[model samples]
Target: MERSVEMVVALLGIVHAGAAWLPLDPELPAARLAFLIEDADAKVTLTQAQWLSRLPVGHQAWTLDALPQASAFEPISVQANDLAYVLYTSGSTGQPKGVMNEHGALMNRLHWMQDA
Candidate 1:
């Protein structure tokens, strides 16, 4: 959750499972965190054990320590138009706005960056 290898793996796992990921900064204020969770309607949050108490009520939190071991995984089918991730803009106008990105759009941007 605080920019570590676990965070990377969790992100990969989310995308692999054909679910969109909304990364919330751990250092954000409690109110902001609550707002983001509510706005995103997040069902599960993957974080370390220490951060569990910080999460809002009703949201499920899973720590890496408590996760079961897996030998292999099957890839979930995802279309190019499927939502890949949701990024929030810095709330300069008061409330942060969520920007939804599809897999195709993100891939195109990545390809353009490489060519540039």
Candidate 2:
């Protein structure tokens, strides 16, 4: 919510768990957020305690402040081709479209950038 260090940690946690992370802008309309959450079928959302009330009903969420202090977690095995994240394009013409990206694709892009 505040773009603090917790946000980065949460993102890293999601990736480390071998699950795709979808970011939803907090400034977006409540209806839009609800739509995206439903569309993504998000099982859990990470946010600050203050923002918990803004989430759609029946949605499961975890507050960063309430998370355990321990950072250690078991490694999850994920293939290179497994999904890494899903980003949405601005829905200027209509509803936003989700673009899926694979871990291998992102890794390749990052490697290319470093090599260049």
Candidate 3:
């Protein structure tokens, strides 16, 4: 949370573990946060201890500080078609829409950006 190193590591860890990460900005309203959690059907939520109590119900909260550090990690196979992450639209018009991005698509976009 708070755009720190732990947040980066958590995002990478989630995808590396073959799980799609749905990042919820803590600054957003409580109703929006609850809506996102409900729509995503998220199971575990990794966040900082300070923000733990703020999260809406329905997630098994795991504080980033509690997570192991540089622990032995085994890389899992992730296919190009596999889900990479789910990002929500700004919802300026109405309810935010979840955009499911696959690994292949994300990589392609990144490569394109690099070329540009």
Candidates arranged by TM-score, highest first: 1, 2, 3
Per-prediction TM-score, please? 0.86, 0.86, 0.84
> Which of the two candidates, 2 or 3, achieves a greater TM-score against the reference?
2
How well is each residue in 1-116 modelled by candidate 3, as lDDT tens digits?
57888788888778778888888888878788888888988877788888876788656888876965657778889999998988899989998999989999988998999999
Error of 1 at 79 (Å): 0.7
**Candidate 2 at 39: error in angstroms?**
0.6
Cα lDDT of model 2 by residue, 1-116, tens digit: 55878888888878788988888877788898888888887788888898877889889988887865657677889888999888888989999988889899978998999999
Off by over 4 Å in 1: 68-74, 113-116
Can you give the lDDT of residue 20 in candidate 1? 88
User: Which one wins on lDDT?
Assistant: 1
Which 10-residue span in candidate 1 carries the lowest summed lDDT?
67-76
Candidate number that wins on lDDT, 1 or 2: 1
